[model samples]
Target: MKAILLIGHGSRAKEAKDVFIKVSNGLQERVKSKVYIAFMENATPSIEDAFVSIREDGVRYVDVLPYFLFEGIHIKEDIPEILREMKEKYDVEIEFKRPIEYHELIIDILIDRLKGAGICI
Candidate 1:
């Protein structure tokens, strides 16, 4: 089956990790595909670890979706590098999606957050 690996720059805060997992679960429901979440650092499941779990579950194709907003080093270099290694080790078809860049929908979400913080722009 096709699977999705949601990648996040793991945070030390429990709340951040919790939010990531919640989003992953939601995505799994919406996409109807097996979804796995992993962190680049400071998280329990690393990319390699998550890959192993999904591979064992018979997932042959993986869409490595980055839960990032910017195209920083992590998005550009780190993820690709890790995915290359994982592909070699697991022999799976892996595709990396770029970070969610600026968009009107993102702007709407930002405005909502700002309004909630009592800071109207």
Candidate 2:
């Protein structure tokens, strides 16, 4: 089965994990793929370790979904660094999925948040 790895900037708050889990849970159904999470820092399941676990779990393919809102250091550098290492280390091939912002629907959510905050639309 295909696998999905959701990569997020790690947070110490339990709420962060809960949020990631909730979102991942919904997405799991759509892809019918194994979904796992990793944090960039300050949380469990570092990307290197996650990749090792998935590889050990016999996952043949992976689509790494970055749980970031914008293109930053992690997206531009840190993630690709780890991914490159994982790719060479793992016998199975892998793919890093793009960030979510390419879709315009994110603007809808931002607009809604602004409206909720009493900003004039």
Error of 2 at 52 (Å): 2.3
Q: What is candidate 1's lDDT per residue for 31-51, written digit by digit as tens?
A: 978889999999979999998
- Lowest lDDT sum, 10 consecutive residues, model 1, at 25-34
For all candidates, what are the clash counts? 0, 0
When summed lDDT is taken over every stretch of 10 residues in candidate 2, the lowest stretch is: 92-101
1-121 in candidate 2: lDDT tens per residue? 5789998898899998889878988888787788988889999889888888898899978889999978888899989988888888886577877776667898888899999999998
Please provide TM-scores, in order, for all candidate models, with all chains considered together: 0.94, 0.86
Alpha-carbon RMSD of each model: 1.2, 1.8
The whole-model lDDT of each prediction reads 0.92, 0.86
